[model samples]
Target: MSAFRARPPAIPTTLVDDAVTRIIRWDFEPGADTGVHTHGLGYVVVPMTDCHFLIEEGDSAREAFVAQGAAYRREAGATHNVVNAGSEPMSFIEIEYKQAL
Candidate 1:
């Protein structure tokens, strides 16, 4: 009786039950920052809103303009600091794989 039907599910990357996949939502006000940290596993990010990002690696830092609904992937073990450089609140969804040590 519905006008629209649901879509099928997408293929998963891993099959292990213990392999952790999580979605994290970040909200940053203007001039807010996330301190330097190292990622334990690979991650994919999708920005929910437009943002100006300042990513710092070691002593060097780069500025990027991230548009809404943009997807990006990153390698594991990467370290960086993130800063919000826009006038509005910046938000993004982060999906990271979990691995046991």
Candidate 2:
């Protein structure tokens, strides 16, 4: 197991929720975290502010940097917790794409 500890869950604001997608704004104070979760649908992340992330999976942790306005996409089925490791607050928008049900 890793020594990584997650702080309080980051604040989430849902901006849009429709059949096609779910858009959410995640705001994190320095050291705030997104508790462990698994992604059920493909998604894209658009950084509103430059993000310094400390990502913790089952037994490992890593750091990532995403510049403001840089959007990235990912497939589903990933599980992890995210922490804001920078000194300042940061936020990002997540748009999850729904699959045919």
Worst 10 residues of 1 by lDDT: 5-14
Highest TM-score model number = 2
Overlapping backbone residue pairs in candidate 2 total 0
Among residues 3 or more apart in sequence or in different chains, the pairs in candidate 2 whose N, CA or C atoms overlap within 3 Å are none
Clashing pairs in 1: none
Which is the leading candidate under lDDT? 2
- The local lDDT score (0 to 100) that residue 65 gets in candidate 1 is 98
Write the residue-wise lDDT of candidate 1 on 1-101 in tens digits.
56342322111233233545766677777777666679887888888899799887998999999899889999988898788777777878778777534
> Can you write out model 2's per-residue Cα lDDT over 1-101, one digit (the tens) per residue?
68566476699999999998899999999999988999999899999999999999989999999999999999999999989999999999999988555
User: How accurate locally, in lDDT, is each candidate?
Assistant: 0.74, 0.93
State the local distance difference test value for candidate 1: 0.74
TM-score of each: 0.75, 0.91
Instruction: Give the distance in Å from residue 8's predicted Cα in candidate 2 to where it truly belongs.
Output: 2.5
